[model samples]
Target: MTINRHCPTCRSRQDFRKLNDDEKAWVRAEGSRSYVDNLWRCTAVGCLTYFRIGRINDRGLLPEKFKKEPPADAERP
Candidate 1:
């Protein structure tokens, strides 16, 4: 399922989808809970940037959180 949310990369509100099982697992393996259930991906063509859905601190804007490859010790999703 997809929902509309603000995408910092797109610099506007865009369609977003939750991370799949494998993607969630990858986030878990990265050892960061910040992006576990809160991460979303922009669905715009040629713009698949991942971002955090929740806010951190007092900032009222959604922050983009790009995904990186899993660590060497971490299993690939």
Candidate 2:
């Protein structure tokens, strides 16, 4: 499972780091194949948003609830 180290709030690709080894392992255990409860913190200037990184399945992660739905125009003939 690959975790993204980018800040979801600011969308910054730098200055963001993963949690400690122990924490990561714990998160993996708690999450399922469809979702991994990984955590990340942004350290760019004033941006201090803590976010959860997880696997993207038909539905999104635990905290961020997302459901996939087809486009409205897909049924057009």
Best by TM-score: 1
In model 1, which runs have C-alpha deviations exceeding 4 angstroms?
A: 56-77
- Clashing pairs in model 1, backbone N/Cα/C closer than 3 A: none
Q: TM-score, each model?
A: 0.55, 0.32
Model 2: CA > 4 A from native: 1-4, 18-38, 55-77
lDDT per residue (tens digit) for residues 1-77 in model 2: 33345556556564544545554554466564323345554445445344454421222222221222456797688
Model 1 / residue 59 / CA error / Å: 12
Q: Return the top candidate by lDDT.
A: 1
Candidate 1 lDDT tens digits, 1-77: 89897777678888888777776776677665644677776676556466566641211212234444446766655
TM-score of 2: 0.32
Estimate the lDDT of model 1.
0.61
Candidate 1 minimal-lDDT segment of 10 residues? 55-64
